[model samples]
Target: MESSAPPSPELRLDNLRSLKVLGKGGMGTVFLVHDALADPSARSPFALKVLDKSSINSHHTNLDADRRARWEIQVLARLCHPFLPSLLGTVESDQLLGWAVPYCPGGDLHVLLHRQVDRVFSPPVIRFYLAEILCALDHLHSIGIAYRDLKPENVLIQQSGHVTLTDFDLSHKLKPKSIRTAISSAPAQDNFPETRSKNRRNLTRWFPAASENKKGLKKAKSARVSPVSRRKLSFSNGEKSNSFVGTEEYVAPEVVRGDGHEFAVDWWALGILAYEMLYGTTPFKGSNRKETFRNVLLKTPEFIGKRTVLTDLIERLLEKDPTKRLGYVRGACEIREHEFFRGVRWDLLTEVVRPPFIPPREDGGDLTASGKDIADYLCSLKSPPPFPASPSSEYQRNVSYGEF
Candidate 1:
């Protein structure tokens, strides 16, 4: 599903223009950019994720954060799949680290889900999207990479409306080793149930899939889920992580318990994603972070309507025990064989003439629109303020495209 290829040396920061800010996070910013040079100018606009070396050096988990940023670039460098991203180029300076990849104009599944009737997709739509997502995850696993984060927000739609998984910062490399270590990722405040729900409330929250305009549902600022760490991580062939990571609602029971987890956690999150796609909200949501963890550990997903293959799929995925979860034993191989995906032409997903949803062209799709200098934004983040100006600030990808 993927091949490791070196990035081109010709693509660099100076020739690239940051047209607009696509998204932002604690680690970096994603910008919609196009190459000013003739070669890149021929292609459409792509995304650049810039990480400030200054920012990476300031965090308590600075080592972990730096590793993740580099690892994500490394992951992109090797990826060559229709449902995944490929490295356009990379940049590294004394103060900045960045990389570029194709930009998906269709936004993310979170926004797409909200645009649907009653804020949920039809079964056919869900199946189409899920199939593509599953393929993306399967490809990642095949390369010994586990996609620990599998929320709707991370599923971005291409211009063709097919899905591609983003945000590899939380992804883990799989190693078939049984050895266990005492290593834990990050602090307990971001993972444990003992963390007060009040302070935890503001962090990347599990928003109920609902429209803020529909019923006065209050939509808070979007939060980015943190990563959980473990000394040894693997899946299918028997590898596990003791680290607690993932969104509150989507976190698997094993992860919550700090028990060893692996590729099964991705399946559990997939079940949650499918559930949200079917129903308007996730099945295990609670009033607070503590309650959410409790529900993940103890709650059974409540399903409406009569039994069906789809519901069955979600149930099997939501199994409290990771070992019992669908796709646990065989990875995505088993899940693809399930009845819900019966008749799906898994191999031809990318070749399908018309995907369920194709994004219409917009003004932002134009590559040459005069944009602000990337250096202006890059320099602004070189030195962070004494405190964060706001939870949500804009940023983009960075670095020099040298030999991979």
Candidate 2:
């Protein structure tokens, strides 16, 4: 049976006095909401992400989508980091179902990148931001969760210059042993086999099958032949499956090959994001999806033109071979001590400070607006912000890349 559509403003549960649009994508819409219960002096604006129940019902099986949403909420509830958005509350009304998270007035990294398109971030600034992200990822992994989706849109910066990671719908608790086993069993073409195995094993564990054990194992082995096939496996156990979960340009080769992927996928994305921040565009981009996949699979990223210590750091992180990538082999501490981040004081990063870039604030400003406001803000000025238009404008203008 189909569920009812979400509630309109008048029918919403909480007393949201003011709302401003933050952004919109394939998932749904995000709004900055003024929570009546919050102290006005505290600046406690919350982000309300409304899942389009009707859209999910039309495009996907409701139960699976609902479970994914709930799982995201659960993950958010359990996590608390200085650089992580705090989950305020969850609302499940007959008309609408969504969760409320702390609103960051500065918006996401994608917006920041556009605002500073021609400009290059100083090494210290880049190190500061990247370190904070790494710290967040370390915390998530330490707690057994794998943040499968990592991109500029999923990262938010506050007006105070603090960075936080958000959007937990695609994340999952990692089982290292299972992941290791799967990676070890995977073929050579697949580099990050650990991540893929963990996801498949988790699916099998959570949604036990009634099929014969031997058949299930055979089916699992056959599914490992291609990335698309493995993605289908992820969705089969009554879960919402995303064919291409991460941004195409930033996806790791292992993920593209379906050999096996693991937490290292996040690091690869970080490398891409870091490169974009310093150079104004991704190092590797293709004219088409197939070309892009091929580039990821077989091509080495070109770091042509001038070089900096940061360039070498990004190249290390973007390495196609997971075993050679930073953190995977040498670990995070070693990566932190590299020449690119030589002057960085890791302990100081955690302290609240202003970010290097921020959107212009207005008098009597309401950062917590509806989804429309967010979309308008993103597309209003430049739409595509002129970042190496090798691909089509539609691909370039999409700031969130359908992940959020």
Candidate 3:
């Protein structure tokens, strides 16, 4: 937690210029913006999430929207990691509240995946992306935060082509039971003795990560990915969330059951994500939401071919029971050492200068030319900002869990 984005002078909506809408989601609009005064030539630009004050407060329940906006800003202000966004500045006006972070020009993982020949990533590429994502999630967890949202859309690619996570409005701060509890919750240490014996060779017969037979991961171009939600779901031990939240396709079984959940929900979502990346579709996605939840709770993920290390990793991660999930007991430390990443040098992730994709440079060439006032432009939108009643925030809608 140190400041990485160069500090910007105080900014006001009046002085900012909106160049493009990066995305539209349940919370607000993310834009590519520049400070007209700070970067007069607009040589440097950032991503800004703007929320309309009036629209956010329209319905009583919209208070949740307001709280999440502020919460995201607070989280960004406190983060300083290569795979995480750092707050550049903020704007609070009578009509709007906005904050800025580094603009990731390389687009999102979803867009990158579609750019691939089979709309999926190879095993090695998946490993590269997941490793960075794992680090980002681990960093957030280190500070007691549970990231309920873990989808490709939230994974942004920097100009350098490396990934960084965005949209923290759905994240929750958690409290572990105790130092002793954190250390003692090893998933299978008693049964798996690879760390201390020659049995390591046989471990893969029992567990492995993912494998690839599709076209190799290829270079991709920049594209935008919108934000989504996830529930922290644990109401017990002061360490779980009872709230039902998250994209239906990636929601965990406990979340569907409304049973208390904790950090394990994220690992479940990771399983869903890995499955999608490997096969180009989610495992539990049925014709409808009810069917999907039923599949999540009852159906096993169908594999296309013989099991590989990658498939094994997904299997362990996708365990329907959160308590039995691979990462449940030890968090990311457990997953990082899976057979798929046996020889990886984790420390040098950020040092890689080139990745599978690199975004085209902007350098104010188009920025200075666009002078649309951000505040006025946002105020002119025919639709309102993300409020409690907006169609965009589907996670907030009443879910018929009984249908499953």
Residues 49-94, model 2: lDDT tens digits = 7665644554446766677777777777666677776567766655
TM-score of each: 0.77, 0.69, 0.79
For residues 311-363, write the lDDT of model 1, one tens digit per residue: 78899999998778887666777887787676665534444534556676555
Clashes of each: 15, 23, 10
Ten-residue segment with the worst summed lDDT in candidate 1?
395-404
For the record, the alpha-carbon RMSD of candidate 1 to the native fold, in angstroms, is: 13.6
lDDT of 2 at 84: 73
lDDT of 2: 0.57
Model 3, residue pairs in steric clash: 209-309, 209-310, 210-309, 210-310, 233-241, 233-261, 234-240, 234-241, 234-261, 235-240
Candidate 3 lDDT over residue span 340-362, tens digit each: 76665565555444455566665
How high is the lDDT of residue 44 in model 2? 55
What is the Cα-based lDDT of residue 64 in candidate 1? 69
Candidate with best TM-score: 3
RMSD, candidate 3, Å: 11.1
